[model samples]
Target chain A: MIVVKFFGIARIKFKEKELHLEASTIKELAEILAEHFSVKPKEFKQFVILVNEVNINKLKMFRTKLVDGDVVMFLSPASGG
Target chain B: MERLTEKTALIIGCGGLGGYVIEELARVGVGKLILVDGDVFSRSNMNRQLMAKEETLGKNKAEVYMKRLGEMSTCSVECHTHFLTEDDADLFERADVIIDCVDNVDTRKLIAKLAKAKDKCFVHGAIEGEEGQVMLVTPDSKVFDKYYKSVDDTIRHSTYSYAVATVGSVQANLAVKALTGKGGKFENKLVIIDLESVFVKTIEL
Candidate 1:
C-alpha cells in the first residue's frame, strides 16, 4: 500500500489527512483519488506531488512508479501572505 | 552579524508575512531594506500583520513600516508606496537578496522571474490557515515554476498570525543564510510547516 497524504488547500478540499491506496504509478493514483474524492482528474495538476519526500517532477512526474511502503503527499501552494 | 550591516534585502509586499520579515531583518541588522507595498493597513490585517495597529490604520504599509523600523533600528530603510511591476526590475538589481511575501500568485511569478533574470537569491514565503511554505530559490532553480504552475490565483486562502510569523521567520533565516554564504542546503528544497499537526518538514524539489 502507498501511504498518501494531503496538505494545505488539498487537505481542506479532500477533508482527509491521509489514506492508504494501491497503485503502480502516480497517474493511476491520481485517477483513483479523483474518483474517490469526487474531483476532476485535472485538479491533481494543481498539486505538487511528492513521493517519499521528493517531488515527482524531479523524477518522472505522473509516470513515476510507486512502491509499497512509499509515502506520497499532495500539496497545494499557499498563496496568502 | 557584523557582516549583515553591509547586505541589502529587497522585500515585496508589507502585509502579514512581509511585516514579520521586515521586523526580523531589521532586528538582525540587515544594513539596508527596500520595501514595496501600495496597500494600507486595515482592520482585517490587525489579526496577523505585525505593523498593522490601530494607529497604523489607513496608512500605507511600506511607509508605515519605514517609519517604525527607522525609529527602532539603524538600518537604512527605503520604501516604494506602490505595487511592484516590471518597471521595478531595477530594484532587484540593487539588492543582495529578494523576498516574496505577496498575497497573489501573479506577483510571485513576476518576482521569481525577475530574481532569476538578475541572478539574485529569492526567498519565497506564504501562509494559509494553519499551513505555510518557505522556499529558497537560487538564480538557477526552477522551483517556483514547478510549485506554482497550476495554482489558481483566483482563489484566496485564509491566513493566521502564527502561520505568517512562522513562515516569515523561516524566510528571514533563509535570506540571512544566503547573505552569509550558508544557504546551500536550502537550494532546491521547500520547507512546509503545518501548525495544526505541529510538524515541519523539507521536501526536495
Candidate 2:
C-alpha cells in the first residue's frame, strides 16, 4: 500500500484527506487520487508532489514512479519565499 | 538633491508589492532607489497596484516607476524596468537592501540566491488571497534555498484581492523597516498575516 498526503487547501477537498493505495506509477497514482477522491488531476497538476518529505521535483520529480508503501505529499499553491 | 543620504534599496519587481514599496520608501526618505521590472501596466494590475492608474496602462514598469517616484522626492532613483536573474549578479551586489515584489516564487528564489551569494540582506514578501508573509534572510539562513526545494520554476498562479493588498503591505513595511531600521521586525523569521481574520502569526525557520 502507498500512502498519499494532501496539504493546505487540497486537503480540504479530499474526503479521507490522505489515502493508502496500491499504485506503482505517477500516472497510476494520480488516477487513483482522482478515482478515490473524485477530483480532477488537471486542476491539481501544479501542486508539488513530495515523496518521503522530499520534493519529487528535486530528486526525480513529476514522472517519478511510485512504489508500495511509498509516501506521497501534495503541496498547495503556497508561496514560500 | 539626489545625494546619498542613508542606505540604498533595490526593489526587484514593481507589481502590486513593488508599487507600495516605492510609495512607502518615498514617504520614509530612503537614501537611494533602484527599481527593476520588465513588464508594463495591464488592465489586471490596476486593481491593487499602488502605482497603477488608468492613464499608465501599457507603460513600461521602469518608465512608470521612474516617473512616479520622480513626483514624490528629489532622492536618487534608478529604474531598470527589466528582469533580474543570476545573470544580473552585478545588480545584486550593488544594493544595501533588497525588497522582492515579484509575483512568482521562482523569481523570488533566484533573487534570494543572488542576494545571499553577494552577502546582502534579502527581504522577501508574497501575497495570496488575504494572506501574506514577510521574511528577512542573509547568506546564513536556509529559508528559501533550503525550505523550498520542491517548487517548480515553471509553475505559476493568478490570485488577487484586497487580501493581496493588505498582505503585500506587510512585505513593503518589513522591507522599509529593514532599510530604515524602524519598528519590530523579522530578520531570520517570517510573519504570516491573515487579513481575513486580522490574525498575525510568526513562522520561524
In terms of TM-score, which candidate is strongest?
1
lDDT of candidate 1 over A33-69, digit per residue (tens): 9999888888898788899988887899999999999
In model 1, what is the error at residue B42, expressed in angstroms? 0.6
The 10-residue segment with the lowest total lDDT in model 1 chain B: B150-159
The top-ranked prediction according to lDDT is 1
DockQ of 1: 0.72
Candidate 1, B81-182: lDDT as tens digits? 999999998999999999999998999999999999989999999887789999999988877887887765734667778999999999999999999999
DockQ of all models, two decimals each: 0.72, 0.12
TM-score of each: 0.94, 0.70
Candidate 1 whole-model C-alpha lDDT, 0 to 1: 0.91
Model 1 collision count = 0
Q: What is the C-alpha lDDT of each candidate?
A: 0.91, 0.70
For model 2, the stretches where C-alpha displacement exceeds 4 angstroms are A1-81, B1-4, B153-158, B180-185
